[model samples]
Target: MATNQDKNHPQLKFETKNNTVNKLITVAYFITIKYNPDHFLTMFKKLYNKDQLYLIYIDHTCSIEVKNMIQTYIVHLSNVYILDSFYLQTDSHNKYKIQLNAMQYLLNVSAKWDYYINLTDDHYPLKSQYRICEYLSNNKEHNYFIYYDKSRYDLDTYNSNKYNYSGLIALKEATFSESRIIPYMSNTWLILTRDSCAFLSYSKQVDHYIELYSKSLLPSNSFFATILLNSDYKRIIINHDQRILFSKSEPIELILKKIKSNNHFFIRKMNLTSNSIIDKCIEDNYQLPLMDKKENKNELGLNNNQQN
Candidate 1:
């Protein structure tokens, strides 16, 4: 029963034995596609499990047959959602809508899950499922993870030259809203806790501004960053939300080397066409501290709950 994974030993049990389960994470994939997947589905099937609720959305142009076919393939999945009947995402620079389209699905679809992740179609993990989960479990008590330089002024102070831009936006019919900022941010692969998810899932005020702004062209990065700064929320953490930018293959071994030290859960922006890149990363002698499935939800905080 012990196979290559065991042979490689992605994670050492003794290393993770002391870690505790942190928070409950719901990994939701908002895949928007023009064509039904042939090869990528197989990769997704391998990478994903019943634990993740894959919320896939077709761009309205895809045929019904393809939708159902994909639906049938992903067992234990009713999390898939079709986009607005009239919405057409192709050729439109509507990253706001694209973001909101996915959000709408998550908000209306499943309410029980916590720590939902927003990933794109091109995104793929460089680590095994088991590896990521374990690390999260270890950090459960810490609500805040990002390290900000103490020299910087308070984030809410607009004069805090550390940032480029920030703002809020709506998701749907005056129903939901998300505040975001830019410049200081990278791509939006935020691993939000349950409380944060709840606020995003059910806020009408935030939704109104986002809806108006989504209709125009603004900075995606700034929008979320702005949201983080303005909100009553205690702290905002930022890093490479997208794991590794999947432009073209450089050195799979080198990439894995970085991920291990980073301690962040996911790396992404993959060339979906190339399966070999991932295979090589997995096969590489290079090791990452792969966390267990039960561990992805944990974080620790020294003074997290104490209001400063």
Candidate 2:
């Protein structure tokens, strides 16, 4: 079991505001990146907040140059940490282990954060940090992720022998005989509460499931949802992950349209090619000086009217 540490870590210190409305809801972000350090840096700058914690994992497959580049960029930021000891191919069940490690590290690092969010290098924030924190503060009790029972399509794909897997069959058989726990699937993206994160990080049941799913195909996709849904945490589960998924084949215009129509906080699979769209999203959602200037202008008008 992971022990909760004091809010003030000797290495880092964050200020707590007295005003509830102005208080920032701190988030611990677990980020996994393999390639494209440039794109990762861009997203990192946008998401960086002194109050939040970022634990970044660079895949072992990446070159040393890539690793150094990332390390150099975030070296000065106390809140940002690179998980230099962890090296895993994120395409497999190792992704699940990486997240577990991050959860434990985050728990030990500080007790001040309210939520944990996992992201990848391909992801970009649809809203500013302030906006995301505000929304999370308002919806503190809810956990966000998309989950459902195994679909026929998924079963067919797994059973088709497209990938080598004796583990999936064994897991299904074991679950069938047990009748207490069943398999569940979901996307890797999640916004989990600190309590839920603690449960996942330290539970012995989670350790058992880790052993069971170690050889299963795409364990990262199934592991988190299966545990949360089958546990008491299910009561706080919300089906939406608050993220927009995009494909490289999709038209930029259509992608922008979808982003505009949706209230999602983040979007994934973004690359340098989509810089224009990313810029547009930032312009619209980021709490920039332009936005503050506009608000100030409006406030001045209100003040004049009140004086009159």
What do the candidate models score in CA lDDT, each in turn? 0.46, 0.68
The best candidate by lDDT is: 2
Q: Which ten residues in a row have the lowest lDDT in candidate 1?
A: 293-302
lDDT of 2 by residue, 1-308 (tens): 11234344333222222212348688899888875667887787767766688888888888889877776666656677767545557775677788888898889888888899999888887766776777777766677887766633345213213264433353455443465665766778889889889989998878878766755666777889778766543336667787878877877687777666546778877664647755666566544211111111111123233110
For 80-198, candidate 1 gives per-residue lDDT tens digits of: 44445356554334544565555666666677555456555555555544455454445442232222221243332122112334642222212222323222322344565545555
Query: What is residue 81's positional error in candidate 1, in angstroms?
Result: 5.5
Candidate 1 stretches greater than 4 Å from native: 1-24, 34-36, 63-65, 75-86, 90-93, 140-185, 211-215, 249-253, 259-269, 272-278, 283-308
Name model 2 segments beyond 4 Å from true.
1-21, 151-171, 233-235, 251-253, 275-278, 287-308
TM values, all candidates: 0.60, 0.78
Pick out the ten consecutive residues of candidate 2 with the lowest summed lDDT.
291-300
